[model samples]
Target: MKRSEFIGEFDLDAVLTELSVDLDIRVTRRMLAGACIGSNPEDAYLSARELRESLEWIHEGENEGKVKLTTILSTACDDFQRCLYYCVAGKGVVTMLDDLVWLEKLLEARGRIAGHIYRNKLPVKPLVNPYVAAEPDGPLGRFDPSFAIGASWSHDPGPDYDSDDRGPGPKLKG
Candidate 1:
């Protein structure tokens, strides 16, 4: 099929089917928002709108055999990496090195969560970011803000750096 024709059929459902292992509307939305590109503002807006509608459809329990959000996201990350590999191998457009770094971090975080879940077998509650507040009447109605946000996890001597002390050199810029 022609690229234009293929793209035309690549709707949200198609994307979800491609990326989803187990998915939910709200979580699916949150994932997409994190993955949204800012290079084209209009495209971002349209993408969000489309994603919202698509997720709503799933939220209403329209899609059959849907899986868990984490699984879906894990599969998505894998699929994204595969696509990147294909792009490079096929001499197609490749994502920026910074984007690759970010993706690598995402993959690592996902792997950690998957490993933790596999080891624990406990219910892993989704920590909805305060910035992207979940609707009270939405699918994820019960808000679970148990996780920390914007906190530095590094051991760097923050704000206490002494010029003469030479503390592990300058810390990497976030």
Candidate 2:
């Protein structure tokens, strides 16, 4: 599946709820909001730190059939990275570098979670069009023409067309 399709199909809140149920980890929107919009730098740092530690704990446990947990942690890591962007936007780059360092640690933790999933051979359902065959080299190999909007057809000039800088005109059939 295309990356855009995968992103559009994945539901972060649903995955978070599934992870919370499977791993018994309480991940709340409030915690995420605190990480994203803390009152001060220290508070933001603390929130990110706590979230990262929680991810580490989750990674250490057996997550055989918890593919949703992996997705949740990956989403959390992306949220933390976005928070760093906000930090850089508000504060100078020099100060935000410290946060960048912390973000790297969080990324590493996320990688470990991914590694656990890969190692356990977890079943990740692919988001695909049921009408299309599931073969990689089949009809799905080509981009769906329906996705093309406002595509210019000027490049395709039919035979017997005069090219005197007029370009291709719309063709009509009787």
Candidate 3:
């Protein structure tokens, strides 16, 4: 998305389709944004979409849990957003790289259908894993995951994220 564009302007299905190389899915802008409790609508929607895409491989038949992937992803997005608020509100500091690393572990555990269906539940709280050994894949400076922030995910003085000029990083409360 262009810096000039507001997040509400783009269709979420189109964004997901493009992000996934034209994979057909029925997602609306509101459904995308509805999952987050964050103040920044743009970031919330972006994070939800990314989480959805990451976990979309689980088939309905494989999912024995009452909660859907959408619901699980929504909770995950809320956790992510709460961390963003924490850092932006100056409650604590979590590096963008560390945040990504944390998320990657969540995805790793959740990628297994059995694990996702059995380990995660409704009203899921932020989870911390001790096995995140993967090195962070993106730039380590700011909250710039290409999935969430797009190309302009840097520590530049442009994006107006929750009245904090700094990039939207998350500090997960332990």
Question: What would the per-residue lDDT of candidate 2 be over residues 9-127, giving only the tens digit for each residue?
Answer: 32212332343243221122212333332122333445455434433333344333133323323342224433333433322222223334444454445445445645765543332
Give a tens-digit lDDT track for model 1, residues 16-135. Answer: 233333222222222333453211223333323333333233334444212222222224222332223222221111112222333344344444554565475544433322223212
User: How do the predictions measure up, each by TM-score?
Assistant: 0.23, 0.25, 0.19
Error of 3 at 139 (Å): 31
RMSD of each: 20.7, 24.0, 19.9
The TM-score leader among the candidates is 2
Question: Could you give candidate 3's per-residue lDDT for residues 146-167 as a string of tens digits?
Answer: 2222232234222112232235
Residue 155's C-alpha lDDT in candidate 1? 30
Quote model 2's TM-score: 0.25
Residue pairs clashing in model 1 are: 22-67, 22-68, 23-67
Candidate 1 Cα lDDT to native: 0.30
lDDT of 3 at 126: 33
Specify the poorest-scoring 10-residue window by lDDT in model 3: 22-31
lDDT of 2 at 165: 31
Give stretches of model 3 more than 4 Å off: 1-80, 84-94, 111-174
lDDT, each prediction: 0.30, 0.34, 0.31
> Which 10 consecutive residues of model 2 have the lowest summed lDDT?
145-154
